[model samples]
Target chain A: MKDRVTTPLGAVTLLLLLVAVGLGLSSPLDVNQGSLVRLMFVHVPTAWVSYLAYGGTGLFGLLYLITRKRRWDRLAMASGELGVLFTVATIVGGMLWAKPTWGTYWVWDARLTTTALSLVVYGGYLLIRAMIDDPERRARVSAVVGIVGTLYVPINYMAVEWWRGVHQTQTLKLLGKVRFDAAPIYGWVLLIATAAFTLLYIYLLRVRGIVAARDEAREERELMNDLQGDLNSLTPQGGLRG
Target chain B: MDKYAVYVIVVYVVTLLLLGAYLVWLAQRLRATRNEAGLTEQVRATSTPGNQTSSRQTPGKRG
Candidate 1:
């Protein structure tokens, strides 16, 4: 059992994360924000990974609908679960950083509000899935939820611009003209941290998929056992089922 | 730096704890399932009428 748990991907992720942390420490601090800026290494990437995980959930959900495959559903479910985890991380990181800078743990900033809303939507997706016992029906119902819940992601992203919220505007943009507004060293460290966290999300997704697949298999086995028991009860002691 | 050290430590530590907990739990779960499935396979093999040899050396055969 000890030997059975090897994970090359996980090991790599850990190493990369260590490197990211080292870079973060060595990088210069913000002139105004000071050492508190180091929190961005975790904060920014956690938010990005949350968004990525939710997008993965919606993508897999769409594929499940199109192909009617359990694999897609399992991936979608894992993605949604991890999406929630990362979002929680984002919130925690944000709060921790906010206390030092904003002098408060929370504010009614539009970005924060929308991110919280998206969290609730995905949380409901998991809750709804748990309520349905039928595997096919559970997948079908949650696939719709997963797909629709992710519609909030874009809104969450645009919240800063749309509402002109207190949260800082996007300083690192991937599309359109590339933007890296921070110090070059900090930018590189942030990039590495982002890449590391993204990989971490993917590795966790794979691990969680195994859990989902095993659960499905166990349910199928239990259903089969029930059917076998029913058959045994129907047949005579010395007959076919016996 | 020392003034805000607690916040940085908390964020990094909490993130690590959360991640490590989930990963460890997943590994334990997968190992438990693998062992359970193996046990079930061995039971089924040994219980079948003609698997006397397998029954006698089920652990050995698997190893």
Candidate 2:
């Protein structure tokens, strides 16, 4: 049974996914949205994962600055990359859900607007990394960018409440505050789905971080080889002397 | 099917497709990195004098 899992975290993710599907698809429909409410299971969770991913990027970026660890910086980059992917998922999923509910694909509502900003900000975060050549300099500069770029997260969270937009308010809030306009099973499905998405994030982060580290190592090795080849050509013995 | 079922299905299908594509890409990248790193190690190991490997090919570009 254990071997069925690719990784322990992956196993948990798969299990939670199964539970979420079992409950989410079978749960009673929303009074207002009907079967369309099923989309919430995917939309809400992907949005939440985007939050967690960006938050992880900021946290790891800060840690990289403080500890000066290469792995931390690599993990930060991995998280940012994943954040972009999930953010795109969130936006598209929300837009699809919106069309059925609100009869439109998108609006300039506060939450939606800030979400669009999130795509820009995190997208810029990735773009800046590619423009810098030195890894150390890139890590330092992007660590600062990563940290500051996430300032919009809290604002994004509070947008609906503060600005009163067409977008709905958060389903779950901090400090034991919870709101569910649907059946209890719907809530359960949501909880499981969110957990499943969170676990999936962790699993992907682990795999991506390993790949990122190896890529960085390979890049550095290539750079070293280039430098060595140049030195060999400069020697007095056909290298170094020049 | 309900009137809005198509919308629901579209969202799920698109989301799943995007996620599956990302996972596949990640898996391919991991394989590429492993192969590239292995070649780098092999090159370094054989670079010792009198132990030169015939192939002096540089590692190929990665995604």
Candidate 3:
């Protein structure tokens, strides 16, 4: 099972996805929102998984800072990339959900605004990673950004309660009462979708982590070759011939 | 289908397609990297220290 998990997490993710679809379609519609409530299953899970990915990015970033290990940096980058992907999904999903339910595709609601900011901040974090070619320098700078950028997560989560908005309050509150109400079947389906999305994130992260390591190694090799050429060119036999 | 159903289905399709594309891309890259690693190891094993000068030359632009 462990070997299968390591080599074929994507397959496992696909298997789990069957559960998401089955549960989502089998569940009944919301009383108020009608079929529009179906969007909740996809939107909420993508949004939640994006949080999980960003949180992992921050955690790995912190670990990299403490240990000064390249693996942790790679993991952080992998998670951050997944975070950006899911954040895009969340924004798109939210927009679709918003258009039907809220009568508009977007609004200045605190939740929507903060969530957009969260996406932008993490997107910029990736830009920072790309701009710096030196791996260690990139990791160190991105670690700082990764750790600091997570502050937006909580602010985004709390935005609904902090200010009035068209966006509804969170389904699962960190504090205070949980205001979410739906059929037990719907709740279960949403949970399954969340779990499936999280698995997908993990699968993608592993693939990304491997690719990142290989890319970094290739860069190092090329840089070494360049430096070696420079060194050889400086030698008496080579320099005089040049 | 209803308008709301269309929205939901489209959202799901978009999510699945985006993720599926990423997975396919990643799998290709992983395969390429594995092949590159094997080739690198073969070169390292065959090359001798004395032959370093010949190997030091950069490949042609077509490479």
Best by DockQ: 2
Interface RMSD of each: 1.6, 1.2, 1.7
Of models 1 and 3, which has the larger lDDT? Answer: 1
C-alpha positional error of residue A166 in candidate 1 after TM-score superposition, expressed in Å: 1.7
DockQ of each candidate, alpha-carbon based: 0.49, 0.57, 0.52
Tens-digit lDDT track of model 2 for A62-167: 9999999999999999999988899999998888888878989999999999999999999999999999989999999999999998787888888888999798
Query: How would you order the candidates by TM-score, starting with the best?
Result: 1, 2, 3
Q: Candidate 3, after superposition: displacement of residue A199 in Å?
A: 1.0
Model 3 per-residue lDDT tens digits across residues A1-242:
13456567777788889879767755677778877787778888888988898898899999999999999999998998888888888888888778777889999989888888887898899999999988889999999999998777888788888997898887766586654566677778888888899888888888799899899998998999888889888997765355
In terms of TM-score, which candidate is stronger, 2 or 3? 2
Question: How far off is residue A16 in model 3, in Å?
Answer: 0.7
Could you give the DockQ of candidate 3?
Answer: 0.52
Candidate 3 chain A, poorest ten consecutive residues by summed lDDT: A1-10
The C-alpha stretches of model 1 lying farther than 4 A from their native spots are A1-6, B52-63
Q: How would you order the candidates by lDDT, starting with the best?
A: 1, 2, 3
Give the range where candidate 1 chain A is weakest over 10 consecutive residues by summed lDDT: A1-10
The CA root-mean-square deviation of candidate 1, after full C-alpha superposition on the true structure, stands at 4.1
Reference-based TM-score of each model: 0.90, 0.90, 0.89
lDDT of 2 at A235: 80
**Native-referenced Cα lDDT, model 3:** 0.84
